[model samples]
Target: MNVLKPLSGSTLALLACMAAGALCGLVAEPAGALAYLFGQLYLAVVNMAAMPLLVVATFFGLRQVCELPRPAWRVGTIGALALGLMVLCGVAGTLAGALAMPGAHLPEHAYATFGERLLQSAGDAQEVGVTLFDGADAAVSQTSAYGWREAVPDNFYRVLAQGHPLGILAGTLLFGLAFAALSREQTSMLGNVFEGVYRTLEIIIERANLLIPVLAFGTAAWVSAHTPPAMLAAMGSFLVCFLACAAVLGGAATALTARRAGLPLVQIVASLKAPLLVGLTSGSATASIPHTIEAMSARLGFSRGIVELIVPFGAVFVRAGSALYFSLATVFVANLYDRPLGAGDFAVIAFASVGAAFLSSGKSGVATVGYMGVVLSLLQLPAEAASVLFVTIDLICEGPRNVVSLLAVCAVIALVSAGLPSERVMPEPLRAQPQVRAPLRFALSRGQLALVAGCAMTVASLIVLMGIGVGAK
Candidate 1:
């Protein structure tokens, strides 16, 4: 009877799917798997739509800001430091968690019935030094659970969920940038077409998001219904590691931003209160943009121009929170499945986290899975399983991720401010003018396309090499 049928139908279907999965949990282990698979498909559909939406919004925003003259050396230096901080925090936290592996074990079975499932899962063998699971203290030896492979359909779902197809996110980003370029300068006919595409994407993204409550409720209900407390306990150490890494990343960015801003750390923390509140409430950075920029400009004395330009850009590139989340999430999944992380895997994770951050537009919801999907695909992880955790646990840690991202933006603005001599600081009003121009002609020229194509091909070759390595395992 609901008048809005598509919306109502999608919601009902998602809920029913989740309910069925949860009910299955009571039946048997296969039920749990079935429930998990259902959750995975729901997540996959949500995530597949996410990458293009986020990539387009982000690249378009970046292209719009790309023309602003900056002391690139200064901004780059700070940006690099911020990036390094994320990578370092990730590595260090992972190392600490790894070292702690010897003592980790699942909570007692009484806590949740899933402990048996968790333990059965832990039977798979891993390398000598690697700690296979976060909670388990026992080192996995070469045992019966060898040469394990995921169920096929689920495996494919994960591949796409991991989103690492060579140019998938990148291509979308390029298209977004191209779309934005053409949008501003083109005549009505071509412009109208591009606008239509953008509008269509916008509508689709909006509709997809309407399913969040359904997804969230179903995911939560299903988790509560199906997964025993022990499964939750089994996941404790992994969650702890992730939160710890996110904290380090967020904490470090906050400290750095406060220090670099030439203000008290408390003031820096206070400065973020507005944006943090917005980010937490809305769960989207793009939505929080006006508040974040307003707060920065009014309270923090950041010029509106810099705040607007830098914050938006920071949402994409300076995502310390999301970067750390993405990296740690991958590690957690690998750990969950008893997959070993090699040096090459580590490098891929680090670079990919940065790239994913760059590609993500600050729409605060679960679109992160899209980028995560891309990474999982590239790294060849079981992304479907990863998406299961993200949907269920988004509220658990998104706060820290958003805070870290905000701090990173503040830091960039601060760093930019520091490098500008007083004279070069444009008046606040002038800063908002059309300071950057889109070189549409040049951007669409044959040369740029060829260059991008070449880079794409090179990256593809490297990915193939990486795939071969993954295959060997």
Candidate 2:
């Protein structure tokens, strides 16, 4: 029982998926393709929930930030620091990619195959071209003409239904602020309702995450089976560069966290093992929040005031890992196409990567790809092929990406807690919750079963239609 207790469901799932994916990659061609399809289908389903999850989560998170103790500057300071770290990581990754030159000198046949797959997956080259460049002038002109007209939504429902995530985020923030302005009784009532919704969404998101291992397996098998051996070597170089950058940043974050928390680096790392393992296996810092808060408040003895405020805010806003990947990926794709990146191009990558990190964090299934597309377009590089290829190996990078983000959160918590007055710290009795051991069950609820069925049917229909479309072609 003790041995079994140590292995979490996500850890077991990760190992199982790795083994299955490697076996399929080596000996199962048709199965690999099918697995890839399932992976995409799973991503699509998960993505359907990402916007709502982020919207409600951010809404409540902002409330916490707004209600922070009198020195509002503390929250702002932590936020600024987190943002700086994110951008710094991005710059580092870009520099590393520039030096490493991953994916450079790819074999012609491998490049051609990737290009063909990209074109097929993306479809409508004309549309891609227009979206890539044509909107820039209009966007710039609109920005120049900014007024109430630009800020006000003509149709709020349309903005949400059409999946304008930034618009939704803006709306949620505005609503959160308005709620904060309400009378105490009214605010509490509404806040409770919103919190309930947020908790429910969190549960759904957690359940959806159980599919991650299957998604990882399918993606790994497909990439291994389809990609050329030389291309794989190039990808290996990119992975090394990315991992190296993340490790350096992560190590620095650990040192800072330990220093700020007044604990040894080893102690801090040891204390974070549960959250770190969960973050790595789940590939989500957001999903690891409960454990992170528990670790910080209970094990590490941080005050609730600091723990409750910074951790959630950091989870949604601080995205060092995503920023790093975006910068590294942009450089890698540029190299694959033999596109030369000057200083100006690197600057654009850095800025765009940071901007995209904020815009796409808390979303699902390689949100970085969309942001990378924007970066590619800005650099006048062909984006679709690169975007597709990036998605292929996104799962492989997710674990490290999440770990970096978690470490950033911990670092911010430590920094914020250290700066607060000693009196602001919670008393020991309030700081620790009694440990409760309960039987662990691994069964799905009825609602989860229904959701699975619905997703399966939707995915099947989409796959069938896709097959028919291919046959027609």
Alpha carbon lDDT of each predicted model? 0.53, 0.70
Candidate 1 local lDDT, 1-473, one digit each (tens): 23323433343544454465455555554545543455445445544554444444444344444444553454466557557655664455445445444113444452244334434344532322222233221111111011112111224445345554323434444554455455455635654564466456555544544443344334444455554565455566656777666666667667776665556778767656645644542245443454566566666565454465455455545667777677777666666556677878777776666656545543345666656654565666655445655654565566567776776677666666544444134433445677688676534678888999999999999999999999999
The segments of candidate 2 whose C-alpha lies over 4 angstroms from its true place after superposition are 1-6, 9-13, 24-71, 105-165, 181-230, 283-285, 303-312, 422-473
What TM-score would each prediction reach against the true structure?
0.50, 0.69
So what's the TM-score on candidate 2? 0.69
Q: Work out how many backbone clashes candidate 2 has.
A: 0
Best by TM-score: 2
Q: Candidate 2, residues 220-260: lDDT per residue as tens digits?
A: 67667856565455467688888898899999999998887
The reply for model 1, stretches above 4 Å from the true place, is 1-231, 359-364, 377-380, 419-473
